[model samples]
Target: MWSYVGKKSNPRWLWHAIDHRSGKVLAYVFGRRKDEVFLQLKELLEPFGISRFYTDGWGAYERHLEALKHEVGKQNMQKIESKHINLRTRIKRLVRKTICFSKTIQMHDIVIGLFINRYEFEVSI
Candidate 1:
Protein backbone atom coordinates (compact mmCIF):
# COMPACT_ATOMS: atom_id res chain seq x y z
CA MET A 1 0.00 0.00 0.00
CA TRP A 2 1.25 3.57 -0.90
CA SER A 3 0.10 7.19 -1.13
CA TYR A 4 1.41 10.55 -2.20
CA VAL A 5 1.96 13.60 0.00
CA GLY A 6 0.63 16.52 -1.98
CA LYS A 7 1.66 19.08 0.60
CA LYS A 8 5.28 18.07 0.80
CA SER A 9 7.71 19.23 -1.84
CA ASN A 10 9.60 15.98 -1.47
CA PRO A 11 7.96 12.61 -1.57
CA ARG A 12 9.27 9.32 -0.20
CA TRP A 13 8.38 5.68 -0.54
CA LEU A 14 7.85 3.35 2.43
CA TRP A 15 8.11 -0.43 2.27
CA HIS A 16 7.55 -3.09 4.91
CA ALA A 17 7.35 -6.87 4.94
CA ILE A 18 6.17 -9.21 7.67
CA ASP A 19 6.02 -12.88 8.47
CA HIS A 20 2.38 -13.76 8.01
CA ARG A 21 2.26 -16.51 10.61
CA SER A 22 4.00 -14.52 13.33
CA GLY A 23 2.72 -11.15 12.15
CA LYS A 24 6.22 -9.89 12.81
CA VAL A 25 8.15 -7.64 10.51
CA LEU A 26 10.95 -9.59 8.91
CA ALA A 27 12.33 -6.66 7.01
CA TYR A 28 11.62 -3.05 6.16
CA VAL A 29 13.35 -0.91 3.60
CA PHE A 30 12.88 2.83 3.22
CA GLY A 31 13.93 4.06 -0.16
CA ARG A 32 13.20 3.94 -3.82
CA ARG A 33 12.49 0.50 -5.25
CA LYS A 34 16.05 -0.01 -6.32
CA ASP A 35 18.67 -2.70 -6.05
CA GLU A 36 19.92 -1.17 -2.84
CA VAL A 37 16.52 -1.45 -1.22
CA PHE A 38 16.38 -5.09 -2.20
CA LEU A 39 19.74 -5.69 -0.64
CA GLN A 40 18.68 -4.04 2.59
CA LEU A 41 15.60 -6.20 2.89
CA LYS A 42 17.67 -9.32 2.42
CA GLU A 43 20.11 -8.09 5.01
CA LEU A 44 17.34 -7.54 7.53
CA LEU A 45 15.94 -11.03 7.04
CA GLU A 46 19.23 -12.87 6.93
CA PRO A 47 19.15 -13.52 10.67
CA PHE A 48 15.92 -15.40 10.28
CA GLY A 49 17.48 -17.85 7.81
CA ILE A 50 14.39 -17.74 5.67
CA SER A 51 14.57 -20.63 3.24
CA ARG A 52 11.31 -19.95 1.45
CA PHE A 53 9.67 -16.70 0.42
CA TYR A 54 6.47 -15.74 -1.34
CA THR A 55 5.98 -12.41 -3.03
CA ASP A 56 4.12 -10.83 -5.90
CA GLY A 57 5.86 -10.79 -9.24
CA TRP A 58 8.17 -8.01 -8.13
CA GLY A 59 11.39 -7.86 -10.12
CA ALA A 60 13.41 -6.48 -7.23
CA TYR A 61 12.46 -9.37 -4.97
CA GLU A 62 13.41 -11.77 -7.70
CA ARG A 63 16.86 -10.25 -7.94
CA HIS A 64 17.47 -10.19 -4.20
CA LEU A 65 16.17 -13.48 -2.79
CA GLU A 66 16.74 -15.63 -5.80
CA ALA A 67 20.46 -15.03 -5.49
CA LEU A 68 20.37 -16.04 -1.85
CA LYS A 69 18.89 -19.46 -2.82
CA HIS A 70 15.54 -18.73 -1.24
CA GLU A 71 12.71 -20.53 -2.95
CA VAL A 72 10.33 -17.98 -4.45
CA GLY A 73 6.99 -19.17 -5.67
CA LYS A 74 3.84 -17.47 -6.90
CA GLN A 75 1.33 -19.95 -5.56
CA ASN A 76 -0.01 -19.16 -2.06
CA MET A 77 1.30 -15.62 -2.20
CA GLN A 78 -2.16 -14.56 -1.05
CA LYS A 79 -0.94 -15.03 2.52
CA ILE A 80 1.48 -12.15 2.12
CA GLU A 81 -1.09 -10.08 0.28
CA SER A 82 -3.44 -10.67 3.15
CA LYS A 83 -0.82 -9.30 5.49
CA HIS A 84 -0.78 -6.08 3.50
CA ILE A 85 -4.51 -5.75 3.98
CA ASN A 86 -4.14 -6.45 7.68
CA LEU A 87 -1.48 -3.80 8.08
CA ARG A 88 -3.40 -1.16 6.18
CA THR A 89 -6.58 -1.86 8.12
CA ARG A 90 -4.85 -1.48 11.48
CA ILE A 91 -2.84 1.63 10.62
CA LYS A 92 -5.23 4.57 10.57
CA ARG A 93 -2.58 6.87 9.21
CA LEU A 94 -2.31 4.54 6.26
CA VAL A 95 -6.08 4.31 5.97
CA ARG A 96 -6.58 8.10 6.15
CA LYS A 97 -3.76 8.99 3.77
CA THR A 98 -3.89 12.54 5.05
CA ILE A 99 -1.54 15.14 3.63
CA CYS A 100 0.59 15.28 6.77
CA PHE A 101 1.03 11.52 6.99
CA SER A 102 3.84 9.64 5.29
CA LYS A 103 5.51 12.81 4.03
CA THR A 104 8.59 10.70 3.39
CA ILE A 105 8.91 7.10 2.29
CA GLN A 106 11.53 6.21 4.85
CA MET A 107 9.44 7.52 7.72
CA HIS A 108 6.37 5.67 6.56
CA ASP A 109 8.29 2.44 6.14
CA ILE A 110 9.84 2.68 9.59
CA VAL A 111 6.50 3.50 11.16
CA ILE A 112 4.78 0.59 9.51
CA GLY A 113 7.65 -1.71 10.43
CA LEU A 114 7.37 -0.73 14.06
CA PHE A 115 3.62 -1.07 14.00
CA ILE A 116 3.86 -4.62 12.65
CA ASN A 117 6.31 -5.54 15.34
CA ARG A 118 4.05 -4.03 17.99
CA TYR A 119 0.84 -5.39 16.53
CA GLU A 120 2.19 -8.92 16.45
CA PHE A 121 3.11 -8.76 20.11
CA GLU A 122 -0.29 -7.37 20.97
CA VAL A 123 -2.10 -10.02 18.97
CA SER A 124 -0.32 -12.87 20.71
CA ILE A 125 -1.26 -11.59 24.16
Candidate 2:
Protein backbone atom coordinates (compact mmCIF):
# COMPACT_ATOMS: atom_id res chain seq x y z
CA MET A 1 0.00 0.00 0.00
CA TRP A 2 1.05 3.61 -0.65
CA SER A 3 0.48 6.85 1.21
CA TYR A 4 1.24 10.43 0.24
CA VAL A 5 3.71 12.77 1.86
CA GLY A 6 5.27 16.21 1.32
CA LYS A 7 3.52 18.91 -0.73
CA LYS A 8 0.64 18.04 -3.00
CA SER A 9 2.45 18.92 -6.21
CA ASN A 10 5.70 17.32 -5.16
CA PRO A 11 4.34 14.43 -3.20
CA ARG A 12 6.11 11.19 -2.36
CA TRP A 13 4.55 7.81 -1.71
CA LEU A 14 5.45 5.41 1.08
CA TRP A 15 4.92 1.86 -0.08
CA HIS A 16 4.72 -0.88 2.51
CA ALA A 17 3.88 -4.57 2.52
CA ILE A 18 2.43 -6.26 5.58
CA ASP A 19 1.78 -9.86 6.53
CA HIS A 20 -2.01 -10.28 6.61
CA ARG A 21 -2.11 -12.95 9.32
CA SER A 22 0.64 -11.50 11.53
CA GLY A 23 -0.28 -7.84 10.87
CA LYS A 24 3.45 -7.12 10.86
CA VAL A 25 5.04 -4.85 8.29
CA LEU A 26 7.29 -7.01 6.17
CA ALA A 27 8.93 -4.34 4.01
CA TYR A 28 8.56 -0.69 3.05
CA VAL A 29 9.84 1.59 0.31
CA PHE A 30 9.57 5.32 -0.22
CA GLY A 31 9.04 6.52 -3.77
CA ARG A 32 6.52 7.69 -6.33
CA ARG A 33 3.24 5.80 -6.80
CA LYS A 34 4.42 3.87 -9.78
CA ASP A 35 5.06 0.34 -10.90
CA GLU A 36 8.80 0.61 -10.23
CA VAL A 37 8.15 1.47 -6.60
CA PHE A 38 5.75 -1.43 -6.20
CA LEU A 39 8.29 -3.68 -7.84
CA GLN A 40 10.89 -2.61 -5.33
CA LEU A 41 8.57 -3.46 -2.45
CA LYS A 42 7.73 -6.77 -4.08
CA GLU A 43 11.43 -7.56 -4.43
CA LEU A 44 11.97 -6.82 -0.77
CA LEU A 45 9.16 -9.19 0.14
CA GLU A 46 10.60 -12.05 -1.94
CA PRO A 47 12.23 -13.77 1.02
CA PHE A 48 8.94 -13.90 2.90
CA GLY A 49 7.35 -16.23 0.31
CA ILE A 50 4.12 -14.36 0.11
CA SER A 51 1.34 -16.58 -1.22
CA ARG A 52 -1.44 -14.03 -1.24
CA PHE A 53 -1.65 -10.26 -1.49
CA TYR A 54 -4.52 -8.11 -0.24
CA THR A 55 -4.67 -4.63 -1.67
CA ASP A 56 -7.08 -1.77 -2.43
CA GLY A 57 -7.50 -2.57 -6.13
CA TRP A 58 -4.46 -0.65 -7.25
CA GLY A 59 -3.47 -1.01 -10.88
CA ALA A 60 0.10 -1.81 -10.01
CA TYR A 61 -0.93 -4.81 -7.95
CA GLU A 62 -2.95 -6.08 -10.88
CA ARG A 63 0.08 -5.88 -13.11
CA HIS A 64 2.60 -7.26 -10.67
CA LEU A 65 0.93 -10.05 -8.71
CA GLU A 66 -0.77 -13.11 -10.08
CA ALA A 67 -4.59 -12.98 -10.19
CA LEU A 68 -5.13 -16.08 -8.06
CA LYS A 69 -2.79 -14.83 -5.34
CA HIS A 70 -4.19 -11.31 -5.18
CA GLU A 71 -7.44 -10.23 -3.59
CA VAL A 72 -8.77 -6.68 -3.70
CA GLY A 73 -11.20 -5.20 -1.19
CA LYS A 74 -11.35 -3.14 2.01
CA GLN A 75 -12.55 -6.13 4.02
CA ASN A 76 -9.33 -8.07 3.59
CA MET A 77 -7.17 -4.95 3.92
CA GLN A 78 -8.54 -3.75 7.24
CA LYS A 79 -5.31 -4.36 9.15
CA ILE A 80 -3.16 -2.36 6.79
CA GLU A 81 -5.68 0.45 6.67
CA SER A 82 -5.72 0.50 10.45
CA LYS A 83 -1.96 0.69 10.46
CA HIS A 84 -2.16 3.75 8.19
CA ILE A 85 -4.44 5.44 10.65
CA ASN A 86 -2.12 4.54 13.52
CA LEU A 87 0.86 5.87 11.63
CA ARG A 88 -0.89 9.12 10.79
CA THR A 89 -1.80 9.62 14.45
CA ARG A 90 1.64 8.71 15.78
CA ILE A 91 3.79 10.28 13.03
CA LYS A 92 3.06 13.92 12.49
CA ARG A 93 4.79 13.90 9.14
CA LEU A 94 2.20 11.46 7.85
CA VAL A 95 -0.71 13.63 8.90
CA ARG A 96 -2.15 15.92 6.30
CA LYS A 97 -1.87 19.71 6.85
CA THR A 98 0.67 19.22 9.65
CA ILE A 99 3.23 21.99 10.16
CA CYS A 100 5.84 19.51 11.39
CA PHE A 101 6.88 17.88 8.16
CA SER A 102 10.24 16.95 6.66
CA LYS A 103 11.52 19.59 4.22
CA THR A 104 13.44 17.16 2.06
CA ILE A 105 12.53 13.85 0.48
CA GLN A 106 15.49 12.09 2.03
CA MET A 107 14.67 13.37 5.49
CA HIS A 108 11.02 12.47 5.08
CA ASP A 109 11.88 8.87 4.26
CA ILE A 110 14.59 8.68 6.92
CA VAL A 111 12.33 9.87 9.71
CA ILE A 112 9.46 7.53 8.83
CA GLY A 113 11.88 4.67 8.22
CA LEU A 114 13.45 5.20 11.63
CA PHE A 115 10.07 5.27 13.30
CA ILE A 116 8.92 2.08 11.63
CA ASN A 117 12.21 0.35 12.34
CA ARG A 118 12.37 1.39 15.97
CA TYR A 119 8.72 1.02 16.86
CA GLU A 120 7.23 -1.44 14.40
CA PHE A 121 10.18 -3.75 13.82
CA GLU A 122 11.85 -3.03 17.18
CA VAL A 123 15.23 -2.51 15.57
CA SER A 124 17.75 -0.27 17.26
CA ILE A 125 19.47 2.37 15.16
Candidate 3:
Protein backbone atom coordinates (compact mmCIF):
# COMPACT_ATOMS: atom_id res chain seq x y z
CA MET A 1 0.00 0.00 0.00
CA TRP A 2 1.18 3.58 -0.80
CA SER A 3 -0.03 7.02 0.24
CA TYR A 4 1.03 10.64 0.53
CA VAL A 5 -0.36 13.81 2.09
CA GLY A 6 -1.84 15.81 -0.69
CA LYS A 7 -2.07 19.56 -1.45
CA LYS A 8 -1.95 20.33 2.32
CA SER A 9 -5.75 20.44 2.28
CA ASN A 10 -6.90 17.12 0.85
CA PRO A 11 -7.08 13.90 2.75
CA ARG A 12 -4.27 11.50 1.94
CA TRP A 13 -5.35 8.81 -0.50
CA LEU A 14 -3.30 5.63 -0.26
CA TRP A 15 -3.14 3.83 -3.57
CA HIS A 16 -2.52 0.10 -3.91
CA ALA A 17 -2.62 -2.44 -6.76
CA ILE A 18 -2.49 -6.20 -6.35
CA ASP A 19 -2.52 -9.30 -8.52
CA HIS A 20 -5.88 -10.99 -8.53
CA ARG A 21 -4.44 -14.45 -8.84
CA SER A 22 -1.60 -14.23 -6.33
CA GLY A 23 -2.78 -11.36 -4.16
CA LYS A 24 0.62 -9.70 -4.45
CA VAL A 25 0.51 -5.93 -4.71
CA LEU A 26 2.23 -4.92 -7.91
CA ALA A 27 2.49 -1.18 -7.25
CA TYR A 28 1.20 1.77 -5.33
CA VAL A 29 1.48 5.53 -5.85
CA PHE A 30 0.16 8.45 -3.91
CA GLY A 31 -0.53 12.13 -4.51
CA ARG A 32 -3.54 13.93 -5.79
CA ARG A 33 -4.88 11.80 -8.66
CA LYS A 34 -2.76 13.00 -11.57
CA ASP A 35 -0.79 11.88 -14.59
CA GLU A 36 2.19 11.04 -12.43
CA VAL A 37 0.17 8.50 -10.54
CA PHE A 38 -0.51 6.71 -13.79
CA LEU A 39 3.11 7.08 -14.73
CA GLN A 40 4.20 5.34 -11.56
CA LEU A 41 1.72 2.59 -12.16
CA LYS A 42 3.04 2.13 -15.65
CA GLU A 43 6.61 2.00 -14.44
CA LEU A 44 5.70 -0.66 -11.93
CA LEU A 45 4.02 -2.89 -14.48
CA GLU A 46 6.37 -2.35 -17.37
CA PRO A 47 8.68 -5.13 -16.25
CA PHE A 48 5.80 -7.59 -16.09
CA GLY A 49 3.58 -7.89 -19.10
CA ILE A 50 -0.04 -7.23 -18.17
CA SER A 51 -2.70 -9.23 -19.98
CA ARG A 52 -5.64 -7.39 -18.51
CA PHE A 53 -6.42 -4.70 -15.95
CA TYR A 54 -9.40 -4.41 -13.66
CA THR A 55 -10.14 -1.12 -12.02
CA ASP A 56 -12.92 0.83 -10.38
CA GLY A 57 -14.78 3.72 -11.90
CA TRP A 58 -11.83 6.03 -11.31
CA GLY A 59 -11.11 7.75 -14.61
CA ALA A 60 -7.36 7.58 -14.15
CA TYR A 61 -7.32 3.89 -15.12
CA GLU A 62 -9.18 4.78 -18.26
CA ARG A 63 -6.60 7.36 -19.29
CA HIS A 64 -3.61 5.19 -18.38
CA LEU A 65 -4.64 1.56 -18.96
CA GLU A 66 -4.86 1.99 -22.70
CA ALA A 67 -2.32 -0.64 -23.74
CA LEU A 68 -4.11 -3.55 -22.08
CA LYS A 69 -7.68 -4.67 -21.80
CA HIS A 70 -9.26 -2.72 -18.94
CA GLU A 71 -12.44 -3.69 -17.24
CA VAL A 72 -14.14 -0.73 -15.61
CA GLY A 73 -17.55 -0.35 -13.89
CA LYS A 74 -18.37 -1.93 -10.55
CA GLN A 75 -19.85 -5.11 -11.90
CA ASN A 76 -17.04 -5.75 -14.32
CA MET A 77 -14.28 -5.72 -11.72
CA GLN A 78 -15.61 -7.17 -8.50
CA LYS A 79 -12.37 -8.91 -7.59
CA ILE A 80 -10.40 -5.69 -7.44
CA GLU A 81 -13.22 -4.02 -5.57
CA SER A 82 -13.15 -6.74 -2.96
CA LYS A 83 -9.37 -6.64 -2.79
CA HIS A 84 -9.53 -2.93 -1.96
CA ILE A 85 -11.72 -3.74 0.99
CA ASN A 86 -9.05 -6.06 2.30
CA LEU A 87 -6.31 -3.53 1.63
CA ARG A 88 -8.19 -0.87 3.59
CA THR A 89 -8.73 -3.22 6.50
CA ARG A 90 -5.15 -4.42 6.62
CA ILE A 91 -3.46 -1.04 6.02
CA LYS A 92 -5.10 1.15 8.60
CA ARG A 93 -2.45 3.83 8.30
CA LEU A 94 -3.46 4.15 4.68
CA VAL A 95 -7.16 4.55 5.41
CA ARG A 96 -7.14 6.44 8.73
CA LYS A 97 -3.90 8.44 8.47
CA THR A 98 -2.55 7.59 11.90
CA ILE A 99 0.91 8.34 10.49
CA CYS A 100 1.52 11.66 8.85
CA PHE A 101 3.15 11.31 5.41
CA SER A 102 6.12 13.26 4.16
CA LYS A 103 5.09 16.08 1.84
CA THR A 104 7.60 15.05 -0.80
CA ILE A 105 6.67 12.75 -3.68
CA GLN A 106 9.92 10.83 -3.34
CA MET A 107 9.08 9.85 0.21
CA HIS A 108 5.70 8.72 -0.93
CA ASP A 109 7.28 6.45 -3.54
CA ILE A 110 9.71 4.94 -1.06
CA VAL A 111 7.14 4.21 1.62
CA ILE A 112 4.58 2.95 -0.82
CA GLY A 113 7.12 0.71 -2.51
CA LEU A 114 8.09 -0.74 0.85
CA PHE A 115 4.53 -1.53 1.72
CA ILE A 116 3.92 -3.17 -1.60
CA ASN A 117 7.00 -5.33 -1.09
CA ARG A 118 5.76 -6.31 2.34
CA TYR A 119 2.71 -7.87 0.76
CA GLU A 120 4.23 -8.92 -2.53
CA PHE A 121 4.95 -12.51 -1.57
CA GLU A 122 1.57 -13.29 -0.12
CA VAL A 123 -0.77 -15.67 -1.95
CA SER A 124 -4.18 -14.57 -3.07
CA ILE A 125 -7.33 -16.11 -1.77
Winning model by lDDT: 2
Each model's backbone clash number: 2, 0, 1
Displacement of the residue 39 alpha carbon in candidate 1, Å = 0.7
Q: Which prediction has more favorable lDDT, 2 or 3?
A: 2
How displaced is residue 43 in candidate 1, in Å? 0.5
Residue 3 of model 1 has an lDDT of: 43
TM-score head-to-head 1 vs 2, winner: 2
List where candidate 3 sits over 4 angstroms from the true fold: 1-8, 96-115, 122-125
Tens digit of lDDT per residue, candidate 2, span 1-125?
Answer: 33344566777888888888889999999989899989999999999999998888879999999999998898887888888998899988788877887778888888889999998899987
Candidate 3 clashing pairs?
22-124
Q: Per-candidate TM vs. native?
A: 0.65, 0.93, 0.62
Q: Report, for every candidate in turn, its global Cα lDDT versus the true structure.
A: 0.62, 0.85, 0.62
Ranked by lDDT, the better of candidates 1 and 2 is 2
TM accuracy, model 1: 0.65
lDDT by residue for model 3 (68-99), tens: 58886656455556666665576553564556
Error of 3 at 74 (Å): 2.3
Against the true structure, what is every candidate's RMSD? 4.1, 1.5, 4.8
